[model samples]
Target: MNCLLTGSSGIVGSHIMFEWIYKALVEKTVNHLFVVIRNNKKPAKDRLLAILNDSSRPHFLNDFSMADCLSKITVIPSDLSNIKKQTLEKYNFSTVIHCAGSTSLQHTTDSKEKVQHQNFNVTKQLLTELPHNVKRFLYISTAYSFGIQKDKVTDTIANFKVQEFRNPYEKSKYESEKYVSETCAKKNIISQILRPSIICGRLIDAPFFETPKFDVFYAWAIFLNKYARKASSDFRIWIDQKSGLNIVPVDFVAKAVLHAFLQPNIKELNIVNPTQILHKNYVGDVLRYFKINAFNYVSERPENLNNFEQLYYKTIGVVFEKYISVPDLQFQSETILKFINQLNLSTNLGVHENFMKLIDFSVKKEFKSSYA
Candidate 1:
């Protein structure tokens, strides 16, 4: 059977592509691979080559050549929602891995519309346009799609209202999940929605690339690092210290995705780190890493701050404060844990040494400069 994988250029998708390629190289379960990438200045094949050559993916390049891998894969350049029926017929895919989606946190009209279109519309179109041979559909969604709910988020479709979303991205993904659930049931498709929490950089350093990094918290931290001169040590950002952040390294997430994909019976999975870090501690670690001043956790925003302090708060707080202010969420991971145990995968939660390695990886890659 062949596989159709989308978002081959993204962090999670690229890692997934690498894992699948490695699996294909060894097991040969997948006969052909169709990678769907967005139209850009660079060709899809060129982009895939860059990913294969990316320093973070050295494991994939250990024993293979670009020519050898490309022989088994077809890079399709087009909007995912616009994939033609003829192309689907030609590929006759059995496994469809839908990892492409808009991930903007901005709430502007255009941004919201784009998020909805890319996340929701693309899923609808793919479900409708895919051929009958397609058996498995794996969707990459965020655990934050649980929204501002109180209960623990389990391996089930969250029943969240539109207003509960922190931003358009979450709302769009929630809507897309609902649509995928309904469509899969109606069309008798075996679907798996994988909700990963706060995917960050790997624990290994890599070469610098001009591409944008997908980690939002790290991006904000890097921004602060670049503009460290703009604000003084007195500047403080308030947050709830008790709230927990369920974060996972990108490499771990990739392994979880593949393992969950091979599981016997699964409808939904929460690919999250078992040991969650406190939001306040996470922020403190970042600030200390950047040599910034200390910050105290408060229930509400503090008053009487300097102009630069206010600007700093507004700049980073607007997009990320919701995470720090919300109540802690419990992301159930029984299914993924089972798979990890069965596969004997590394369940290394990013803490202490791993955390430092992750941040250092970003530093080596100069994420601060590019993001700032």
Candidate 2:
């Protein structure tokens, strides 16, 4: 079998690439692996090698030598946003793993709609315009794609009926799932959708608790870092101590994706942590880590706010209000559990310890990002 994968340089894609190339390629389960990298300044293979060679990367090649993996790999240089049939004609792949999409922070209708268009266009091109050898398609979507369901969110692939969405990302993914499902059905292709919750750092994996990006949970963590540092500011938060935040480490996500694409039994899988991080524990961890004294949780928004508090609401606070305050929605986990059982892996990878590791690493970096 031959496989084609996109987003080879992204957080989840990198993890999947680092450990599985040898097993898939050398073992002959997948005869060859085609990796897609958007080459701007240099060749795509050079760019992929640069990412693999970076010492600060959260993942590594391990016992799998870079040369051995590269031997059976073909680097396709083309952005999914502007896919051309001529670029992909020579390759024959039995599987297409579509992992690249817009995880943009832009919330406006234009921005969100633009993402939807780009995502849909890429999916359409991959299925119809790319080489006809693709017999299986795997889509990487977010668990939050179910929309803001206060009740239990199941792993079912039915359409989400909700009045509101937390953000445009959720909205886009929801639409993308529908499109992928319908298109794959028409094409007589086997499709598996993996909806991973908030993509996080490694826990039990070899390069323990490392991450390439600092967003989502880390975004608000950065907000609190700044909020607590202000001597005159009050550290008040609007949260229910018990509201659950669903997050899964990237390693497990990669593992789940690896397991899903190799077979055709799975239709939809919620790749989420078995146990979620509660607001009380998360707040306590942050407050204790920073030694913030005036810690207070409010059911309602504070009537009058200080300058910083106003700024907080105007910025990241407003962005993440749904997460810290929404009802705890339980993700269906039977499929994920089956995968974990088969792999002899544990979902509970010392939750608190891993959480603190993120806190420590981000704090050491002073919560920096080129995008943030």
Lowest lDDT sum, 10 consecutive residues, model 1, at: 203-212
| Highest TM-score scorer | 2
TM-score of each: 0.90, 0.91
- Give residue 18's error in model 1 in angstroms: 0.2
The clash tally of candidate 2 reads 0
Regions more than 4 Å wrong, model 1: 158-163, 204-214, 343-348, 368-372
Show how many residue pairs clash in every candidate, following the order shown: 0, 0
Task: State the lDDT at 12 in candidate 1.
Answer: 78
What is the per-residue lDDT of model 1 for residues 1-372, given as tens digits with 9 covering 90 to 100?
578988877777877777777767777755677888765777766777777776567354477877777777888777787877676777657888899887788778998999999899988888888888887888889887777777666777544343587888998988888888778878788888888888776642232222337466676766766776666546566777777667776766777777767762677888877667777656777776777665566677778877666876667677777777767666667766676576565564534345655665677677732111
TM-score of 2: 0.91
Q: Which residue pairs in model 1 clash with each other? A: none
Q: Give candidates' CA RMSD values in order.
A: 3.1, 2.6
